[model samples]
Target chain A: MEVLVTRQINKYFYEPEKFQVLKEINLTVNRGEFLSLVGKSGCGKSTLMYVLSTMDTDYEGQLEIAGQKLTGKKQDELSAFRNEHIGFVFQFHYLLPEFTVLQNVMMPALKQSKYAREDIRDKAMHRLKTLGVEEHAHKPSNKLSGGQQQRVAIARALINDPDIIMCDEPTGNLDTYNTHLVFDIFRQLTSESNQTIITVTHDDEFASKTDRIVQMSDGRVVV
Target chain B: MAGNRFQLTFEIAKVHLLSKPKQTIIAMLGVTFGIAMFIALVGLMTGLNDFTEDITMTSAPDIHIYKDITKPRQSILQQIYPNDMVWVYHQKPKNELTKVRNAKKIIELIRKNELVRGVAPALSSQVFCNYGPVQLNGYILGVDIMEEDKLFGIKSKMKEGRIEELLANREGIIMGKGLAQKLDTKKGDRVVITTPEGYTMTLKIVGIFQMGIGVIDNVRCYANIGTVQTILQQDPSYITDINIKLTDRHLAKKIAAELEAKFDTKAEDWETANATFLTGVIIRNIITYAVSVTLLIVAGFGIYNILNMTIYNKMKDIAILKAMGFAGGDVKSIFMIQSLIIGVIGAMAGLLIGYGLSVLISKTPFNGGDIISLDHFPVNFDLKFYMIGVVFGVITTAVAGYMPSRKASKIDPIEILRGQ
Candidate 1:
């Protein structure tokens, strides 16, 4: 079954004069598929990622995620939907500096409040253990190394057991060893839990390892 | 669900504030100083106002009724001519007695009214005091001693002898402190007083009192009404002034007007008689509120500046939280909760410090120097003023927080994420 779909998507930028950023884009990904979107800089791959994540709503398209149409939803409703169904990881390890690593991982689950606080904590600790960052959980997130913080960010994304995980250059700042570790985690998440993974990456090697690759040039998807 | 949201946001707000303790304390101090000053200034000012009012009310009656001497407007010619405009030049004044007619009957009618607390009929005459070599002119008022005491609490003002001594000795008089000093007479000394009509009488000084007013204490004395009547060679029923104390002094003006029309006498209320003092009180109150509000607004600006800087510093954090599925309202609530916490805590500390300051002021020694017998500074600790202070402080902080929080809420997360 398809986990995400976008039909004839278009986006524009009006600063310093109007310019089309994305044109006539259609994409689909099936459940449990690990998909990579590959393109050079300024090819609108990041813009398409933001639109698919529902964080950027200024676009002309029909977006369906988990069989639910999300094209005309209110911002708050979209936020709630994202909280429950979608998770995000960015190139930068964007953890709150003041919050402890464990607390940072527990934040989204706490906000969702679907489980008791203790259950949320245990789930967060379990995710941290899986990412091999449980020993650093009590320290402030800012105190962690770049590779360690990225792993913690992944742990945070998985705390809510979301249906789809979206990543924008998730290993862009990591070394080869840490990058391989993150790729293996994504592989296990898709194969074991049937969770869909979508990522935008400049690394052709990383794109080749994913289950499917969507290549883009200028603003259109190419074969 | 709402409660849970608030709790999460509040926790985030707490972490933000605690991360920079120094900045939070500085913002809190601004509100603290503003509210504290408001309380102390208003308390001391109103206390002084009440002090002056008390002195005035004690020395003067709420309403004073007497016959006014004036020239007749009609002059007989205008009344007989009716429609004609008659002019009279250098008109002589009409013969009218200064004493209120049927004073006892009028006092009885006034005493029957529910608003009248007490009525004291008095006869006053200008007298010349002769003590050995010195002769000083003064005014002597004769009153029923117990009634006068009940109206003005005269017993509290007596410094030398009891007011009851005047009743025991019909020939006794209670002279003012300054008058007794000028005459070089003690409480038991006898002084000869000659009325304006040249009738002389030797009266013993039974007591000495101070009203804390310079004019009254310098040239006024009190005696029995019969003694004054005998000295003036008047009848037993003669009364020049009727002093009325009311249940509520605010009712004096209306009751005075009614008494003037009913008794054909001139009546003056305390407020009309002391208009300048009342104006001073009003002006002081205006200044108090103006300065207090200005202080609170200045403090509010301090809070606004701090919150704005906090938002600027936390721009990345806000964007991340939004990207993590927190709504714009949650972001707004986080900042708002921070300011409200500061406001409530700061205001509570301010109230405590304000009460301490008022108490310290009230304990400071003050010398009235024969004008008034006060021993310490007066501070009115009115609960109403504190209530106003706290309410104003909270509202000021809330308004200050609102703008910055709204700006934080409207920030587009994609912009920050893309810029990074």
Candidate 2:
């Protein structure tokens, strides 16, 4: 159940003589497999993640997510697939500041799915309750505690029930206790659904929990 | 695919107020204020224009065929036709000269034409009315009540006595309010009227009126056409001006053209009467557009400020949404919806405030008869104003949203994710 595969993926930033971010990258992630890509700063792992997400298509790449080819697709088709199949959790939660915690979870629902109001509402409440932050559902994202906010972010990522949840440093800004709390939530999510999880991290402790480890140095995958 | 995305977009936009209702409200206030000013100013313009046209339509008959003195002289090629000159006979009262003038029946022959609705002979006398030491130099007119009313719209605008009331007696006269005041005369007041010949005749002021215009109110008196006909001692068939009435006002120029063709002379409509009125209409339109554009700029700035801030704060979200499989166009639409939300709120606020302001202005006071009048500035917020508001509102908001939407669209997802 290989969920994602990449062959000869190459991402270039500007002139190759000056700044080239990725070159000849190759990787694959299996279904229900928790994978982590560990790298130093400026190693272009984030650039690779963006290409994987279909956010930047300027790179030369043969990329597939859930066995569907991801290249040269219309912007709309890519958005639809991303909304329906892939969940994203950034280093910063990046939840709309104006929206409540429930609204943050419901953001994907509103963005992609055409469920009735009650369906999205029910799902949002359930996700918030599951994440044990139903109390923060009415509160704005910025109002929540650091650990609570990261949990809320995880809830948002899961609301769409996406096949793959890709997190870029989910606890990059949190304290050690909050970091462990967020990682524990991530472990809980993958164990419950056997969902595919891809995390890009600089921390070995966080990366060691993953089922597979891919190391990157400079612009290419080293191991 | 179902387009509930718009509802989603709108929901997001609406909650903008929830996040920062104060700022949103401040922005909307700009909208409300802009629209209110627009409505009030345009309403007053409409009211004034309506008032002017009303005065013209009520005081002057629908089709007045005065000469076009201001017209550019006919090109030599255009003047090939004979210049037809129709004699306008003025009347003389109690004199055989009128009868003798009426005796010649050739010019009266045009009365046979069915297009001629009425053929009234009129007389005018300019004399200094000595009303108990208030010597007011004013005009006095005499006309056939039935025929004159159809020509000058006299009976229709009468505030006091009926035109028939003036026609019944030889000495009956109607005076305007200002004139009535100057003469110390009212309804049923007896005033001595003297001709330019110094022949004094005591006449009863049977009516007093006001036409809402001061110039007309200050110096106007009318009596039966035949009465002045006898007094002027002119030809009976002669009217100083043959005031023509027509079936359609828009066809006035056509009728004048036909008359010019048939009579071999020139004719003009009220549009060309003063020449300055047309210029005034153009200037007023320019003023309306100028004011509306200025308000639109102010509104655009308000929306621009909000939208620009929106994109800056949502930079990471821009990256996230883009990463979530949203296109550059989608991101633009999201920001665009925000500006459009402002537009909707602003436009609605404008309409509400505009209506209130219009009503408020209708009751506003000013220096009487100095600029326009001391009365409520006439305001008619017609359909045109709303059409203007809608067009400019959408355009301005879309434009204001453009910079931010494009910036959002151009976000490099990698840089944003890396927190750069």
Candidate 3:
């Protein structure tokens, strides 16, 4: 089944002047597919990623995710949809520094509130263990190394068992070793468990190793 | 599911507040002192009100029954003989004293009422107290000593001499210690009273009392009802006033109205008799609350500034919270809960502090010769004052927290993440 489909997407930035950022962009991703969007800086890849994740509702488009039309939804409804179906990994890790790694991972699950607290805790621990950060679960996120924090952030993204994980330069702030380690985790997640991932990246090697790469120059996508 | 969401939100708020311990403490203390001052000031104001009520009520009867000053007979005569030209020209004296007839029957009727605690008949007349060359104008109230003592607590106020001696000796009188000082007389000395009806009599001073009220102490004297009636050249049974005490003093007004309607006489309760004094107390009460609430709101502003700064600094975390699927409303409640926690803790601390301060003030003694001499300063520690403080504190804190929380909630995640 198609997990995400965007039709005739158009976005603009009104600052300085009415400037078109993305024009007539169209894309689709299949279930369990691992795709990378590769582009140079200021090529609208991050903007497309934000639009696809339902975080940027200013664009004019038809966006259907997980078989549900998400266009023109209220912010709360979109938030609930993101909580249940879509997870995000940002470049800076964005783990709440005041919380323990386990707590940070459990935040989205707690927000979902579909399961008991104990069940959420157990699931959060399982995700931490899967990411090889369970031993550091009780430590505050700010106390972790750069690589460890990124791994914990990825674990947090997966705690809700979301269908699609959208990462905006997830490994952008990491060393090559941690970058490859995150790449390996994403590859294993898709191949072993059918958890789809769409990542926007500037790393040429990272894009080359993905199942498929959609390269962009200016605002047009070229396979 | 909704309940679980609130738990998560509270956890986040708790962590955020704890992360900045100093700011949170400052906010809590602002509310604390605000509430403490509210309780303390209200306590003192109400305490003074109670004290004034006690002093006024203790010295005077709960209800005073006197003859209604009758209007001139011309109006009634004209109504009976309307358009009679000769009656319209006939007018009676306006300043004539209207005496209460059948005083014995009215006293007997009031004494039988279940609510009535004491009833005493008194004959009051303005007289001149003369001690050789020193002459002072005063009013003499003639009373049955025992009944007056039960109603007015007069025996306890005696500075010298005995009130019962007035009953034994018809020529004896009890005067205020201040009046005795002004008249240059003492207990067992002779003083002359010249009545308005031109009857002069010499009376031996039997009791000297001090009520600590300047006017009453300086110009009031008491004598036997029969002696006062004889000196004023009136019937032995004729009395100008009937003073009453009730089981419940607060019910005096209602009962006084009833007595006025039933007996066709003027009845005045302590509330109406001291209307000006009560009005002053009420105004003080209003001023107290106004000042207290203003102080509390000022403290609320301090909380607002602190929370505003915290939210500004935590913009990134707020954006991340939203991106993690917490709705704007959820984020707003998280900050509100933090303020509520601060308010509740501050209120509790403030109540304790206020109570301690009140007890401390109550222990401090006021020396004699001050405005009103008392063994200690009066500070009422009423629970209602503390309750007002807590409620005011929480409301002010919530108002203060609202604006900053709204700013935090509206933070756009895309905007913050785009900074990367």
Index of the highest-lDDT prediction: 1
Off by over 4 Å in 1: B70-72, B89-92, B126-137, B181-184, B194-200
Model 3 C-alpha lDDT per residue in residues A1-223, reported as the tens digit of each score: 8899999999999999988888788999999999999989988899999999898999987999999999999999999999889988999988899999999999999999999999999999999898998999999999999999989988888989898999999889999899999999999999999989999999999999999898877777866
Find the 10 residues in a row with the least total lDDT in model 1 chain A: A109-118
lDDT of model 1, residue B306: 99
Off by over 4 Å in 3: A14-17, A217-219, B67-98, B109-118, B128-138, B155-165, B180-212, B246-265, B367-371
TM-scores vs. true structure, each candidate: 0.96, 0.85, 0.89
Which pairs, if any, clash in model 1? none
Candidate 2 lDDT tens digits, A1-223 = 7888988888776754767688899888888878888889889887788788777778886989887997888777887888888988877777777778888888888777578768998998998888789988998788988788888888878877888888888878799998888887877777878888888888899898778888898989998
Greater TM-score among 1 and 2 belongs to 1
lDDT of candidate 2 over B245-338, digit per residue (tens): 5555566666666755655434455666645865786788789868977987888888788878867877877777776666677777777887
Over A1-223, each residue of candidate 1 has an lDDT whose tens digit, in order, gives 9989999999999998888889998998899999999999999999899999899999998999999999999999988889988888988989999999999999998888777888989999999999999999899999999899999999988888888899999999999999999999999999998989999999999999999999888889995
DockQ of each: 0.71, 0.59, 0.70
Query: Tens digits of per-residue lDDT for model 3 on B167-280?
Result: 999999999877899888989999999987778999999989888676788888999998998898887777999999999999999999999999988999988999999899
Worst 10 residues of 3 chain B by lDDT: B366-375
lDDT of 3 at B118: 94
Instruction: Determine the iRMS, in angstroms, of model 1.
Output: 1.0
Residue B233 lDDT (model 1)? 90
Q: Which interface RMSD values do the candidates have, in the order shown?
A: 1.0, 2.0, 0.8
* Every candidate's lDDT: 0.92, 0.73, 0.88
Worst 10 residues of 2 chain B by lDDT: B95-104
Candidate 1 C-alpha lDDT tens digits along B155-249: 99999999999999999999999888888989999999998778999999999999887678888999999999999998898999999999999
